[model samples]
Target: MELVSEHVANWTGVRLFQQALRAAGGHRFPALPAALPDANGGSLPADRAAVVLAELDAFAGTARITDEVELIDEATGRVLMQYVESYRGVFMFGPGFQAGVHPEGFFVLDRADPPVTLFRAARFGQRALPGDRVEFTVGGTRTVVAMRPVGEHGEPPPERLAVRTRSRSGGDFAYVVEPLRRLCAASVATGNPVMWC
Candidate 1:
């Protein structure tokens, strides 16, 4: 993410005033510079001024609060819990990808045969941040298997297991079939080549 110093001048001015107050032998108190616009017209409300003073008193350079959570590991089926203080952004992958967020972290899996690609869904709502480790239940019960490919030689070869040949009026169209084992034979055409080892 790009960092823009939108409020840097304002914050710097506040810090300078606080420093001057400390150097003046007075109790260190936060002071608003005259240039800063008051939340209430030209004057700050008593309650708002008090809150600002309290915030300055409590400010200890560069301190921030953080929170923790749990995530899961898809490969080992392990549960990993960790802290995630902020949401940076998300990494996007194309559609139909199934991924899980565990205490170990978030990861996309390749359920297709030969594991075509490791991808994360484009829209996974409020799941987890990049660094956060969380635990989640694996959804969807269906399992896919690898189908042997019939090669041009009419033999199933291991190397050709991912390759399928289809006969068309335009001649033969060759395609590398996705490895989804549970699909019925009717779903696949016979002339389609499967190079099975």
Candidate 2:
């Protein structure tokens, strides 16, 4: 019974193969043809074969296939890579955002080891946004060519809240607006008048 089932499956596969050959042309060979026959019977469907071949073929012609890679930090689960091609168009967050304007459209490359953000410039268009899934190249170092917004736009929260500081010296001592966070305070100049204070 097992052998019979195996034979049945094999027959089904052969039938499918015959159907594919008939679809490509009309003739079917007795045994699986070494290669698909061409319209002129010179070689298998070069065009169709080219579509299936995987290894880099220098002779057939240049084909562009976009893909993605996840950039993850080995030390931390924190996603260090963004704009991976495999993710489709979703953008991943990196340890830090690039200060410069992201190019119009390009995929974000994520590195696995030691985690790094690299941008691919030429392969993008204007459709990519921050946090979008995108396909990109894996070879060579990646560089940012363009970028798109990742999610809905919203006002960023203030880094610090203003507070009143009193000078010990004397006088009425007008209320000084001090930042809630030391880092925020550093960004404010000493003399800048704080409206909230």
TM-score of each: 0.19, 0.16
For all candidates in order, the CA lDDT equals 0.27, 0.27
Tens digits of per-residue lDDT, candidate 1, 1-197, equal 21111222233233333333343323332343332342323433344444433433343221331122224233332323222222211122234443433223444554566545342221121222234322222343222312111111343221201111111210110010111111112123222221211
The prediction achieving the highest TM-score against the true structure is 1
lDDT of 2 by residue, 1-197 (tens): 01111111232223323333333333322222233221222422333333222211221122221222223222333333333222342344444433111223333444456534465342222223256432233345323433333221353212211111111211111111011122113223332221210
Clashes of 2: 28
lDDT of 1 at 9: 28
Model 1 TM-score? 0.19
